[model samples]
Target chain A: MPRLINRHPGRGPALMLGLVPFIVLIFAYLLGSHVRLAANPDDKLLPTPSTLMSTLHTYAAEEDVRSGQVLFWVDTMASLERILIALVLSASIGLAFGLAIGALPVVRAALAPFVAVVSMIPPLAILPILFIVLGLGEVAKIALMTLGIAPVIVRDLALRAAELPSEQLIKAQTLGASSWQLVTRVILPQMWPRLIDSLRLSMGCAWLFLIAAEAIASTEGLGYRIFLVRRYLAMDVILPYVAWITLLAFLMDWALKILRSRAFPWTDMSR
Target chain B: MARVTVKGLWKRYGDTVVLENINLDFADHEFVTIVGASGCGKTTFLRILLGMEQPSKGRLLIDGEPVSPEPGPDRGIVFQRYSLFPHLTVLGNLILGLELRRSRVLGKLFGARRREAIVRAESILEAVGLAGARDRYPAQLSGGMQQRLSIAQSVIGEPRILLLDEPFGALDPGITADMHKLILDLWAANAMTIFMVTHDLKEGFELGTRLLVFDKLRHDPQAPEAYGAKVTYDIPLRRLKNDRERQRLAIVEASGSEPSYAPAG
Candidate 1:
């Protein structure tokens, strides 16, 4: 662990750099809520950070909170679950597609036209069609999110794989690498950086869809929480959740970037 | 321990004849090198011997049997560019050929201990002077180190015919000399059959037991008296039999024509 740390001391600065956005977002949200609440001094029942924090403390103090609500933590949990599932789906699908496209030019040529056409459509534009077919449920959210983000994943992975030096494969073949051996041992590891970048982008896209999907169809999720609170003008409650979501996204992106540098120390060609 | 016979080998790129009637024979454990000016088809010859390229006409036989067009364990090849798998550590790339070639159905379930493979790989890495650098990925190594890795990776596999395509063509003189010594020592140690393609004539003379010079016949057509290229030069390892004979042969080789070629400094 110490040696690994020695290898990448830049991670400390990188993490700090990654934190800039989250800190700014949190500060802006808190400042906005304070000003809004200051102007609405008459409404004690309206959402504010202090009120929501106290309510949160009370809810924790009570041993039980209702499972469904516009502003409870359940939707946040579901959104997280949806994002996690989307990550796995996008990665596997993307990697497999990437390997195929990278190894064979025909596959890339055949799929490129469709990929360009698919990525151009907005994530929200397809949501209604998905809802019409799958109904306003988890299925619609997953389908929309997967369709919205899978192309980037595939594109990045395939591009990375394609750029791999042809000599590497020739070496592997001479080294007695079988078809499967070459893919797993050579092709897969080389494509990780792009895969990591794709994952980060996919997570952001998935999160984006989580909010929009809930806004349209679902009764639960962070998007619904924001919408429900806005009806009653609950800026305080929204700030903390927004802070949590922003902080989580920042952390995930940082963690992946760290992993990318650490895991692929050999790929310092751009260095 | 292997002999290669390339007979009337003809390779064409679409319609351009890259090699025509390339008849050559490499005796057992002989270090045979082919040198040619750019586009004279020296690399194509090496590839054909290694079974990386197929002759549009003619046959390449190892011992008495025709060689496969596809690369196989019987032949080993090192590219001019160090082509070791970047993701793998030095030892990983070295033993990859072994691992991929190891019997899998029952070998993994019931073969030699994993530690033995590691130990052997370490020794091979040491032989290649890459012992300390075994754990380092290929990308972390210098160009010279990567070249050494490529050699180690090929040598450990114990292939019958080791094919090299200008392995040190891009190296500085000092590094090239060191690699030349390292490779010669390894070749002597195993008495391995080596086929190297080079554009550097002196390096060819220093490293190979036989030199197959390409006869590239280019002429100023106005002078219709242009001669066919100097076709071949045998290394005359007559030097190995006795120092005096070796000197005599070197003098003869240095001054001869038709097949006589000068070594580049």
Candidate 2:
């Protein structure tokens, strides 16, 4: 009897295999776009690749008439800056909170339930409150992203810290580590890679909150530009912008993974 | 070197008692081994001695002064598992205590002192036969190597007393033999006062200058918590030089509910 052995593909084959689905989707889109355009050259719904490229060039390569700014670069920079700031703020808060709660029984008993409750409340529901307090500026947008992602990072880190062997804590204590020293030397040193992992896991949710906040109110951002183009049925600009945002997100995720593997190779169980 | 004295020690968790009326004196530079049946409060006793857990009633004294309620450099401990910090390499684990002692900030050992610590750590690693694995993480080492590194880590602190809670309980015979020799060498070389708990009776007899056996003699099913484990025997092995004495002690252990030691010949 013939049997099928579905072994995991190597890097080259895996990459080629990954592109198969995308190639199929593109081929289908191209055929459909061609048919629609053949019927009506004035169709604005499914813009051809050339139309999208030209629109992308105008936004990315050329300067705007009024502001003299490359809108694509400006939007990318604004969105990236907001995300970077939010991620840093949230990760720092999460790591500190998680370390305290996980290491200290009093802190855990006092704040664990409160943190759990806060995490349950969706961040988007409080978007209006954030705007009212912080105004409809970059602060509000970044705050929304931070609020959405920080709690999750906290939960993950706390759980990880709690799961560490009690022996490690005892060993550190026996070595004359004070409570502060124990947390800083033993707990925090071990937690750096896990913190990075928690941040990486929260990145997807961060992007979602970032886009939502920017879409609601922002002068210059990828999300704001996407919403702006949607008003005039500018699918050419909208699709490319969406693609560009996806690319940026994937790159960020890939870079973090590489950093984690390179810097804390011991954390990788597979190795 | 410091003498350890335990007077009227008792430990309880809620309604259930674990250790009851433990009183003993450990001389400086003595190698003491505690052996007992499973769930006989050996580990609980060791934990109390290490200051990781407090006794319900009684106090431990190091030399003439009372031991601190919390763990400190005066006493060090090695557990059967998870003794090494997984994040640190073999050399890093050995130097951690030195680094922490010198630096105010954690994980930031600096300048000439740091280099000195590393050099000392490397020598300790070589002594422990782990020089080749100095750069590897604990997870990268074999179980035997990991235990050796952990022993080095505890010894690096130069603690007056070293507590072991069945540190060789999980290793195979060959590795366990190597560990026993290594531990004995370290103890003699450093002049450390050592206290260890183990389930293996032969191991208890082989390595200990003094052996303490723990057991529960009374069992009341209706009042299960009525009796807790107590030190049944405090035999000084240094004086048991003849087969007659060993046979006498073994016979006494078999016949009586409490451990009895034979008089020194």
DockQ of each: 0.35, 0.34
DockQ class, candidate 1: acceptable
Candidate 2: residue B130 Cα off by (Å): 1.2
- Once model 1 is optimally superposed onto the true structure by TM-score, how far is the C-alpha of residue A192 displaced, in angstroms? 3.8
Query: Which pairs clash in the backbone of model 1?
Result: none
State the iRMSD of every prediction, in order shown.
Answer: 4.9, 7.0
**Location of the lowest summed lDDT over 10 successive residues in candidate 2 chain A:** A1-10
Candidate No. with top TM-score: 2
Clashes of each: 0, 0
Give the alpha carbon lDDT tens digit for every residue of A29-86 in model 2. 8998999999999888889999999999999999999999999999999999999999
lDDT of 1 by residue, B26-115 (tens): 789988877878776777777777666788888888888988778777777888784877767787787677777784332221246556
What TM-score is obtained for chain B in each of the predicted models? 0.82, 0.88
Superposition error at A164 for model 1 (Å): 2.3
Tens digits of per-residue lDDT for model 1 on A7-95? 65378888998999989977886676677678887554445566778766543334434643434456668888877787788788888
| CAPRI class of candidate 2 | acceptable
